[model samples]
Target: EYVTPGGYELEKILNRGSVAYTHVNEVWPNVYIGDETAKDKYNLKKLGITHILNAAEGTWNNVDTGAGYYTGMDIVYYGVVAEDITTFDLSQYFFSAAQFIEATLSNPQSKTNKTFN
Candidate 1:
């Protein structure tokens, strides 16, 4: 069984982690988490971006470019149509998205980014 940590324990654990205020961050080699600007075609081309996982799809607080936007660009695209909200449960996309990210980062020449809206 797992001992569930709660209240101040959880807060303490969470507080130990750090986050930055940057629009784009390279968390691992060839792997990136980027905002709209980073996902721009020109920027992506400059960055040599090989794959893009769009976290914000549709029109509501989203990019709405869809996969077709990257056609003929040698960039692979995957989209998760989601709203950026506190109540929007995104757990459903976690596994598949992770798989996609894993596949994207597996190549030596890969420059993968997950676009944030």
Candidate 2:
């Protein structure tokens, strides 16, 4: 079985660097990782994004744009109500998140799916 590194070890790696501000990065073709600011409709249009997977949903320090938020837009949204706490066990959402992303990516009509991880 795989074990998560101890909190001290994880903290050492996490706190090694200061927080850096950056624009959304395209880690894969049509896939992105960015802050909540990337949810703007105009920006998504400009970037040619067709789908968005929000790993962090809800109103707590996260983008509040659920599916209903993009009314009349051609974009598709997938969301997971995730917390930023270390003890939250983010792994629980991994499979579902991957399935959503895969579905979007595999859709022949979907040219670009931008996921905000």
Candidate 3:
């Protein structure tokens, strides 16, 4: 049996874990979670990432890399100027993010494209 922890308990449990973040992580098939640096063209090409959804954008988080940054690359770019704070209502952007991921992974040509980030 599994019991869901309360907010405070869940927070404590999350804080207890300290896993280092990598440049990119493929948590699901053809879907990736990564930092700002992963937006590099060479790296995207290496990772075969045809689309990128910048969850945290603008100069707020020091990530000013917009669509212009990927000028020469044949990659689709989406951005959400999100603030990394508890008070920020990130849930508002959940649907948009999911849509972007679905579009990216659903590409008929994505499966054969294999690369790294």
Candidate 4:
């Protein structure tokens, strides 16, 4: 049998760092995780972002950019309509999102491959 921990336990586990993150952080050599501020076209261009995996597709308080947002820029986009509620059951998208991130980083034609921090 398996057990899942929720509420504070989960939050605590997810909160891995004390330092405040900026608009975008290069989590890996060619991968990034960011907040809503990263949705800006200028920012994405400045970072040389080749692919985007938006976990919050239609949320108001979160990111709002969709596949159509990058009309002119050369970017690969993927989005999941994740809910901002406790009962949203986001586990279903974990695998697909991971796959997107992996593919984005593994892509040989990726624009850049350097992490600032």
> For this target, which candidate reaches the highest TM-score against the unseen true structure?
1
Query: What TM-score should be assigned to candidate 3?
Result: 0.71
Which of candidates 3 and 4 is the stronger one according to TM-score? 4
lDDT of 1 by residue, 19-73 (tens): 5556677766788888874347888888889898888887786577778888889
**What is the C-alpha local distance difference test score of each model?**
0.80, 0.69, 0.67, 0.67
Candidate 3 residue-wise lDDT, 1-117, digit = tens: 345568998688569875456767665566667774445567778878777777677676655677787787877788788777789887898898777777777775551121121
The residue pairs found clashing in candidate 2 are: none
Best by lDDT: 1
> Compared with the true structure, what per-residue lDDT tens digits does model 2 show for residues 1-117?
345678897788569864355666665565767665446777777777777777767677356668897778888888778776778787888898788878877965563443343
Question: What's the TM-score of each model vs. the native?
Answer: 0.76, 0.71, 0.71, 0.72
Better of 2 and 3 by lDDT: 2
Compose the digit string of candidate 4's lDDT tens values, residues 1-117.
335666887678568665466777654566667775446788878878888777677746357777798888888888778777779887898898777767775775564322111
List the candidate 3 regions with Cα displacement exceeding 4 Å.
1-21, 111-117
Which of the two candidates, 1 or 4, achieves a greater lDDT against the reference?
A: 1
Quote model 4's TM-score.
0.72
